[model samples]
Target: MNDIGGSDTIKPAAEAGRVTLPEQGLWKNLGQADGLESAAQAWTPLMFGQLDCAEAVCVFLVDPEGGRLRATSHWPRTRMPAGALIGAAEAAMENNRGVVRGGVGDGGQLTGGLVSVATPLVVDGIVLGAVGAEILPQDQTDLRVEMRRLQWGAAWMRDVLRRDASMADKRRYSNAIEALNSVVNVAEQKDIATATRSATTALATRFDCDRVTIGFQRFFRTRVSAISHSAQFNKQMNLVRLLGAAMDEAIDQRGVVIWPETQSDDPRATHRHQKLAQAQAVGHIMTTPLYSRGHFIGAVTFERPTDQPFSQDEIEILEAVSTVLAPVLDEKRRNDRWLLSKLGESLGGHFIRLAGPGYLGRKALLVCVAALTAFFWFTMGEDRIAADAVVEGAVQRTIAASADGFIAESFARAGDVVSKDAVLVRLDDRELTLERLRLLTELQRGQIEYDRALAARDRAETQVRRSQIDQIEAQINLIDKQIERTELVSPYEGIITSGDLSQSIGAAVARGEALLTVTPIDAYRVTLRVDERRIADVVEGQTGTLVVTSLPDTSFPFAVRKITPVAEYADGATSFRVEAELTDGFDNILPGMEGVGKIDVTEARLIAIWTRPMVDWMRLWAWRWLSLD
Candidate 1:
């Protein structure tokens, strides 16, 4: 054979190649074909003539009804193209691009050495078919040129494919609109059974299916609601069960499930689908999940004869119909229910969402709330009353000035610790000293007069002088006692809780004036300002704990010693003074330290403990406003 790439070769310059008279006649023949199959047969030979050294050629086109690729025409009319050429065409269609394969043998020998090139015919972003050719081995440039010619030759084929696709789309759209109209009519039915039955029957007739069944998910199980062509059927029937199982299978996968699945489809669990098909002796079956408000609510299953399997276009149309029908059907089902049933179902759906897995954060929060409610409802806790508390000395003493004088000195002040007999305050004693000296001089003079009268033998005069001397002596003793009482001192080891005489040194003070106040150390009492609303719960001998602001980390245990019967009003609230002595001694505690206290009254539920105040207030207000008759 002469080298196909030599000068004898026909090289068409343009991408589509110049159409000679013979080519024009061939194009006319291609146009005359009634369908894509006949046109492919006429076009294959023309394409083969445009390229050099072509051993065999084939044209493949997709079957719109079946959504499958088949060889429409091939060269060498006696036999089919090589398996390698067919594989290249399938691959190009699958990949929606051009594919090339070269054959080579060992030792650089040309063993059946041929190059195959396949180019997919795509139009409007859709792969419609592929054209493949086998030729003798050629250089890379020549191979590229051949591929370009093959692509250009597919242009007419693209136009034909586009037209078919547009027609199919229009038909599909019309069918979808018709299906939607039927669904709208179904929705008009007031009862769920009627609507579901109408929907199934309409789908069966529209798709030319032998039977159609609709199932709704209830209690985590699929229940067949309606079957096509049957006004009434036994739910216990084996056929109904099988149909429900198929629907459940599709629903569980949350996708479309088809028996006799295509090779291009994703692998799925179809054990139930397979069983259903085999048991019913059905040739084909398809089930698609139904969603309402973006939730999987049910499924629809279609059964057809063995001769006609569901095509891609039909499956898409079914999906669209189901999407539009789900919510409508669901609404009908809802309206047909009893009032109580509607509520139960509405709550049931929410409960299912709460109980199921997913939404971890929301579930956890719900669990916490439930647990807290249960704890407060069923568990008992200490029924304690909370109140503002203050630390006070158990026994307090006030030191008053015993004599009129000035505050001379202060040894200790408020918050200071002092031992017994500690000099706390002093007053001015200069005037007392002067009075004592003058009285002593007058007593001495009276003694001298009495001695002079006795020497002159005057008894009456002596008696009078003796009386004046006694009176002067008494005055001197009184002055001396007043001077000694000027100094103030603590009667016991305690803290100076109130007086601060250190700033008033030398200040004049009247007798019996309060110079300082002292409280014994290591003895403290907690005074709780219990709200009047809760004072009824307070009683002597009740135990409680106190936490002072200054010593927050430390808690002092105390028992109520006294509950003042009178209520004191202050700060827009009324409270009763409740005195409690610390049962547990603490050295760090000081008088006047403030804190909060909780008084344990009795055991009660935590809910009651927290809501008691509010409840009491409400009760009181109601009693005041609604006490008539």
Candidate 2:
């Protein structure tokens, strides 16, 4: 028994006496095409002749696929009935082990024992088949040694099968490589027209096809370019139409279409291939799509007779060829004519094509886009002027130090909301206190002097003392006022947007220096940092929406209140500040919270609304250059 596949037949090899290898003298009259019958007969006798004390021997050889088995030849002329030999070999194959069984009762020349022993012959783990023989308990008690002999014989048979399989693979790959080289050679053609002709002819000749047609996408339909072996052909011919339709079907599906696809269940395939083949009186048809950048650009159809249907391998090779062909063909098509001519042809041919058959879906989309553009451009869209706006207070008030003094205490910081008369900061008033005391002492001394002058009745002394007292009183009052103003207070109900007095603690501030800024909460404004380019479109009474980073999903409507004439540098670009008032207030909006705002200057076309920014940019750029020159 011998096998050549991965199936249960027998266990590992065992020790045995060295037997004569098949390459030495066995298989002397063998041939591959005869299914190894002659080799089996030639080798079996040699294997049996080496075994000692065996009553009878019969070899069962299994096919490489493990699907069939045959009794090659029996040794000792008549070992046992043919049925008994086959049954024994089959049992070993099924059980994947050596077995002992009673003979089928038509025995010949097997008087050693009542039972038959079948040992599986396996090579490379492939359960080939088993060798059956009649042996007694004393004839061959060592079963392992007998099984080893069978394996030694099977090794030679496995080699023959492997070599046979390799040769066929080698030939198939060789042909595949040659076909690839032909495709490469065809792609090297300089001109598209010539390339098409050469490629079709080369493909037809190499693949042994009755005919081959190459076609490319013309607008939305396949236009035949070249037909194998035909220099001149009618475009309106029925056969040409059928070929074009078949090519179109393949290209549209982005896959190969094979006629009589009796062996496929692909959902993309159609029976149109069969229809075309039958109409053309061809046995088989195969249409392979050519793609460039994933778009189906063209296809090539092959026709053959019934006896020579295209194999899967041939179709696969053609698919690879199509990949190499598409880009080169596309480039050739582009260079075949002038660019201006192609552009002009495209312009004039568009309307004609739009009204033609096919691409109804794409045409519908084109119509929709055009209509949407017209509606936005001409039907009156909201003319909104978009700008980057910094949220600010409409009326901001500043708290300043009254005199030159060191900050003693900071009662408020930026972002701290406070009411009117809220103490924002306190200044050191020790100097003012000393000044007031000195002035009070002077006033007391002046009063005493006045009393003395009055008691003496000296007119000149009285006048001088009265003037001194008035001067002292004025100085004391001024000191008291300064002390009161040292505690800087907010002038309005608002948030402290700037001037954190905590940073100014113990720091000397001059008279009238701002301590902190407080902007009123009721009056909110968005200072839009609009690009200088679009400043003209921004007027004083427009309205738009605003969205800030903090509250992006919500929109607050605002009306343009003022457009600043000054330009400021922001984010490395020159922009103008346009102030707007919030018409409808929303939460999370606070002064100094920057956001984006759009002002509806007027209604404009959708195209204009979108393109105005670009137009304005171009105008400014041109103006800048013209002025520079």
Candidate 3:
């Protein structure tokens, strides 16, 4: 015997009261039966007659149509088999193997001296049904032998069931192929309306439907597009609206819907379908949704007489046809539209997906982009031209060396505040002092000679002496003025903007050499290096703001005072010099401070303000290389 729980199990046949029949005779008798039920009925009794001590025998066959197991035949036809025998049969079928229970009574307790044996009738790994027998065996040996006999007899049942199943499968396959061919033929039409109309008509004729209608989803609603047996019909008609509503119901559920639904089908909302059926006086109606690329696209509805509800096989075939026709129909519909219409529809579909639920991350990104675009498009801002700027002085005065001498003393350096007449630099004044002393001595001697000449009353001598004294006096005065020039001083009360003489004490200085630069403390101007591309937008009297590097937290308002015509080239770029005067906020501002300045030109859109540079560059590039003939 093999494993009994889930595999074939058998034992030697008992010798006592076993009526053996020839294999040839048994096969011939089984063949004589007309069908599975008849064969089972004949084989059940034969097996019971051969096995000794058998109480009752029954055969269960799987219904090919429903795929359910039911009792086909039983021996001693006066009464039903015991519960234990039926249980064994079902167990064998469920387990797909032979089962043997010994000493089990009707209640499934080991209190009786009876034994039940069941063997499943399997073909091609499919459990067709089972055969069960209750026997009053003499002993364990007899029970095993009865089980072996039952297993052997199950072969006939397996054959019968296999034959029936094969024939049914062949018929379903042939029907499915024929239905597919019909759908393919209909799809040969070039346009959606024609194809849909032909498809509905063909389906109605082939499936014996009274009417057939097709509808497609448009703008989230179902619209009837075609009807069988009619070339054109009013879409606004009550009947057509009802048909569309029914199609919508099916599409919403994303499954096939049938009126007068079967008990085995899942429950679905079908109010529209019911209403349509009642208004149209159609007894049997079925609607199945069409899908393409995993998206619901449309639906097809079929109607028939009350007596002819659709069969499972027909329903399956129709579903197959729908699968084949959906993509073809959808493609044809798309191709039939005008180019502009196609583009609009495509965009509309994408917009729908974007606006609908789901795609949270993408939706957020789209919202942000749209917000930015709207802000740039509709918002107005100052059209300002940005340029590099440096704080300068309104009037710069350079204090230079007055005489050629060594630098002797320094009173001020760069960045120092000073008043008018403040000594900024001093050259060596020793040489001027010596020359003045010599001239003074000569003047005294000449004066003494003049007095002597006057006392002697010599007129010629006196005149000569007087002339020499006057010459010496004039030279002394010249030396005194030269001494004064050696000391450099600030021209006004201002800051020393440049030049440091303290570090260069004792260094040689020349006459008129720039030793220090000074500018009024309260007067400041800003010079901006405006790019040539943007220079045209800048002009005198245009007010702007300036932020210097030294005082970046504060901004000084300025008005453009001048724009130089000359262009300056530096660091591989061209710019123009623009001079602007600070209008206010001069406190803490100093010359030579550099930062960025923006000159306001006019009011403009924010997009233009931000993208002006790039747009200008692109325009220039196109003009240079993409010039048209």
Candidate 4:
């Protein structure tokens, strides 16, 4: 009997009755009537109950050899005849579907004959076995229903078979993995000759091949360097030469090649390989190419007896093994054993691979890096530094108290647009008016007294009245000026930015005290708070755009007018207060409206523009560590 891994194992047919169904419940159609006899015994009873069949039902499964079908139950021991529904069962298994052959006239409940239904248990497209059932006489009225019920039972059997096949495949896969690990361990050996001999021997042992040869590329041609059975062989030997030629044939094709090729799917060049295998009486042959640094480096060929041709799974495993050993073999060819040398070789190999052809992914990445380097090195872009900024009027003037008086009424407040000389606040003027009237009456009396004194020839009286008249005139002029100042007016046609004397009505204000700040709405300057480190790049006349949060959709262009040497601390950073005037007016720009500004400096390479910060930091770091005298 052949085991799951295609290895021959000895087990008595009677022993199969002892094995049981796997613990993991059944899945798809892997059970050709379920696993060997013991598995069938476990499931046949349940299928019998669910299928509405007669008491006697038989399930026969195909043996692993695929030649004969064995009964799962103790059916051969029973009184059932060989010809009893065996044809129907075989038909179902062959067709891979359920079949109901006996019809109403052929077999009916009235005649005491029950219909027979059979179904195939298939898994992964291979028919494993089939189940035959004799429908209950009463339930056999409709052959279609009986067949459907039998099919459902067969589907369950298929699930059971599928599970068994899956477990077998998994076991086989594990064995393949272990074999690969062994070959890989040999490849890891430092000495090339020893590793090659050991790996070849291991491959022959694991794969049960008659011969295994390792060939390497020399001068663009494959040369047989190692053979599994013997380290020393005559190159002049016809068999050895033939094997070398076969390996080279596979290597030149640049892919996995199998001799006695089964696949009509691929365009095959296995003529030399097949001829050599035939001449040597080697049954099967396969060669897999190895690649290193994105170049074809060598090939490993396996030859076995006629019966054990390479399966797709084995071919796949060998291909993976080739890939795993390529780099190691390349390094071994260099004959370098030092750790640092090996590391450098590995890195160099990677660089070569990146620079090599045929690998689209690595090639694409190299192209991208080169393009980016050129773009950053040769292309020039604007060098701009961002700064926190706010809009302010070009000429912001403060409205001050004109005279010492009490505020009476307010006409406008901050943010109010006012015309030039527009009244902003009214001050009390009744006292000034009364003082003006008294001064006017005193002035008239003083003038009359002066004239009378002069006519009566009194010089001293005339001098006193003349001095009083002059003093009275001065007092009246002062009262007139005080009265005029009662109404505080805007200095210009602009918006009131600061003063809000609405709540301070009737409050006394001293002369020259700032009452309001009015700024022209049309003229605006951006006060930029540039970081001290970047302030040097923000000299006067540098032009850029300003974008405020309020009018974010619009960008106002501006030029640096002045850079304040004095620094201010805001948001935990020290920045110089730089002033920039807008080259173009914005209606939305207002005093104290904050936004961010970018100042353009001389154009520079994109690499320099992006990496300036890192370069500056490195310079600072170098300065910190170096003490150059």
Candidate 5:
């Protein structure tokens, strides 16, 4: 006997009670029963469950329509050969009892089992299916008890099969209704392809199909997107492009399209088309609508490779998913629109701020203030009036050389303050001295001659001798006068301000050439120019103060001496020359030193401050207009 768990064969029949039947056992017709007509139709899980048994159990049912055996269920102890059960069922139905089998083989290895039993399933007096049971030694059991149990199970399975067969018609009717509802929901919610895809994917997965696709009308074009598929389908493969025209027509008409097999379609359909059945072997299709705002966005589709089709519950769930997905798609569109609007507003607002009135107004105000300040400061500040001024100088005698001769010596040069008789320049007087000596000798001789002639007193001779003596005295006097004119000298006590030619040792000087100039150093004055407009304000004896650039802060006081009637033109500025002599207190005063003297034009009120610049400007304009050069 084989081990209980490890055995590849069925348990021994001797382990349970066994009953022998006669060579011929009676058969019952199941098709003849009432309500059995509708039960024999399609495959059902209850039939499959009963067929699962040890040692090559076989079950054949009427397929829930009573027309033919729609499916056969089998489980074999050892590996069952492919198609063996189906072929055995067809063969054993000819006799329709339990047929014992022999070892089946082509030549060497045995292919048949130790025992075989054939049973036929009948419903409504019609043959529906047949079952063949093959047994090994380990599978022998109490045939009477097991066979009785199988009969009871088959009765129960008939009810289950009846129920399963009716479900398909109900499911198909309900699915059509659900697809219509999904279309209505999508139309009401105004969602497009997104809703379609979501509904189709969920529905396809629930039904376990090879694929689901959502096809839609895109203008004259048809578009398709896959939503869900069985794991057997290639994830990354692209679909054939021959279905676009059919889908397009179906979607535009708002109707369902079914492609039972894709290979029937033309091979060269243009634009986003698919080949239905051939390569990818899509076996079935069901599609529904997608709508936006009552207008079509697309459709939802489902597919399968084998015999399975979508159930009612799956379609109802998809309708619900479509209803939910519609709003989500609308919300996504709304968010995108809102974001674009916000961006446009932000950019427009920035431009408005840049060109707005506030910016221009502030800029204009700044420019106005700047111009006003500039005009008020530089031009107005420079138009000012200074105090009246006076300057004075003393006139002095000019001394000159009396003769043309070499300067043999000198007694003075520049800056030497001198007295009335100071010798300033000396020409060569040697000849004059010698001539003077000769004149002196001649004068002495003439004097002796005059005295001798006076002493002799010869009355007649006295007259002639007196005439001779007078002539000799006249010659001596002429020599003395010539000697005096050769000496160049200063005529008064003054500071040397002009000539100083003490180095003319052998050079000649002309008669009346000024060898040096001497002005009084201790007798100085200040001179000033009064603008013509302000000259009327000046008085003859107004006290003036002088300041020199060399000693900038110092002031020398002097009384106004005289206002010269002459108007001096100084670099196109016309002013009346006013002179003021220094007081007796300045012993060190000097002439020809540059200074500005201020004469009191008398104190005036603040009104004068305003009028002063105006008065000066009027004078300037008048002078310029008159071409006063």
Candidate 6:
């Protein structure tokens, strides 16, 4: 028998031969009733109603599995008994797809009416099944129609199967996404590397790889930890270097790299990895970069036992697993640094205590305390001197305009302690009033002339009435302007300290000028300047007892009002301006009385004073240099 499998007689090229064009010679060769069973049902009625033809038919199914072939459907079989197995089915499964003239009945009987053609059923890369149709010799034209119908039926089946396969792949991808989410959500406790290794190992087992590794990239080197399945496996360092080098290309370019069958003959791929692969019997290699927070953190690699390239689905799984490992690795690295620092601290403490001089350290401590005390006394207690400072009422002034025009207006001069809004000047409106009156008189004169020019008509009388109305309006305008400029007020209200205008009249004042300067008459603040070297020992909110020279030995309570950051260059020294407010201003105290102010900057243990200055000087010098402005 002629066959195509395992033989030199049927060449691969001969089996690859393509089908002839169907619209011409083969188009008319297929019978209408000789198509697939479903096609036969559709075309049989058309043939019987239109063409008046009825005939026997045969259809064969060609299966790729086991290269088996079988009779799928037959016409007149129920009445005439099952038809014998035909050689046409075997011929159709082979040689891609072709038409052949063959006899039926187990290779015994003559069945020349059979016109068999095989149509391949393929979806993606998988071959499903093929269809073969046989027809009667008398209905040659009808047989051609049947063959064409079978051709279209084969193509339709291929499309339906392909859609189903694509949908299945999508569902698989969705499941992978969910699995990745679950892995990422797991809590990351201490020992991040072990946690990552545990996760990577579990994933590698699921994907059926020889080994799985997790690593992070730092500069030119990649630090890797190999988490193998068997306990006998030790960490292999050389493998880490090679994997890091190989991954740099993919990571820098943001792409994927696949190396197939690298067990031997590749110098770029590490021999150490090859040995491990040999031990584990792996054949394929896939490395994927791990990305987090829009940066490439590291990579994860898998080793397989077969040379088959990883499918896109498998690569997606690796990427998803890498996402889960990224955070765990970063946490582990941070924890490692913390552990080393603690170890260093423990050792340094012991070394310093065992190797230093004893007496010198104690004497140094005592001197430091004394120096600190002196500094506090000079800076913070600078206002607390032996001489006394008195509590006196603040000085104030009130000014009013000397001349009277219209007394235009006032902006809260009386009882108003304004900082800058005191108004003591105004404008005059008498001249404006005179102008309005003059204009009104002119209007009346014009009215009188018009009235004389016309007596019978009352038009001139209307003009005279209009002029009188204008005179009244002018009077109202004069009153408004006089009222607007009628008042000249005091600048500020401080018990009218300087300007007591209730008893004075016609006090001429300038057009625009300051009337008074009002200071608070109840409370008072004493300001003193302290040397810069002593400023730090002073602080805000410090309290001190105050004595007034005017009151002899009597003392009053006081507090630090403020310590200005600005330094004043005065009296051959740099000093900070300090202000202190007393609890009460003296009832009979006067301004400009000479007094002294003092404060206590510190009260510290004696030992701290001696070293404080040197410590402060070193601190300032170090800060100036190291902080670099």
Best by lDDT: 3
Segments of candidate 2 deviating more than 4 angstroms: 1-380, 617-629
Supply the TM-score for candidate 6: 0.28
RMSD to the true structure for each prediction, in A, is 43.3, 38.2, 45.5, 39.3, 63.1, 34.6
| lDDT value, residue 292 of candidate 3 | 89
Evaluate all candidate structures by whole-model CA lDDT and list the values in order.
0.82, 0.74, 0.83, 0.75, 0.54, 0.53
Give each model a TM-score. Answer: 0.39, 0.39, 0.43, 0.39, 0.33, 0.28
Q: Which candidate leads the pack in TM-score?
A: 3
Clashes of 3: 0
Kindly indicate the candidate among 2 and 6 with the higher lDDT.
2
lDDT of 3 by residue, 1-629 (tens): 11111211122256654444344554566787777877876676567666876877889877779987788887756548777777888889888878877685566444445677899888888777889988887666777788888888777677787887787898778677976786677668878889989998988998899999999999889999999999999989999999999999999998999887777647888799889888988998899998986788999999998999999878888887787788888888877888998676546534523645659798899999899979998999989888999988899998888778999999988889999998788789999999999888888888889999999999889878987988888888888999988877888999988988778889998778888889999888899999999998887999999998878789999999999999999989999999999998788888899999999999998988898989888668654544311
> Once model 2 is optimally superposed onto the true structure by TM-score, how far is the C-alpha of residue 396 displaced, in angstroms?
1.4
Clashes of 5: 39
**For residues 1-629, could you state the per-residue lDDT of candidate 4 as single tens digits?**
11111222222235432222222232222233334554565455444444433434678787667678766652222435144467777888887777755524544433435556678887778887888876545544545565676677666566667777787788668656865686577766878777877788888998899988888887766777789979788878887778777878877778888878775666768888877977888888888887888778888889889788887667767777777777787778767457886686456534523733458888898899899989899999999999988888888988787888888899999989999989888889988898899989889999999999999989889878988999999989888988888887887899988979889988999989998898986877888889887887878988999999988889999999898889899789999998988987686677888889999998999999998888877667644444211
Writing each residue's lDDT as its tens digit, candidate 5 over 551-606 gives 56667777776777887787677888777777745543565567566676554444
Can you tell me which runs of candidate 3 are displaced by over 4 Å? 1-50, 56-112, 125-129, 139-149, 345-629
In Å, residue 106's CA in model 2 sits off its true spot by 99
Where's the lowest-lDDT run of ten residues in candidate 1?
1-10
**lDDT (C-alpha) at residue 112 in model 6:** 45
Give per-residue CA lDDT, model 6, range 465-570, as digits (tens). Answer: 6657676666757666554544544333333323333332334445444454455545566665666766776677876666556665665566777888998896
Q: Give the TM-score of candidate 5.
A: 0.33
Mark the 10 consecutive residues where model 6 has the least summed lDDT.
Answer: 1-10
lDDT per residue, candidate 1, 105-194, as tens digits? 555444446878899988878788899988774565667788888888888777766766777799788768976786886967879998
Residue 10, model 4, lDDT: 22
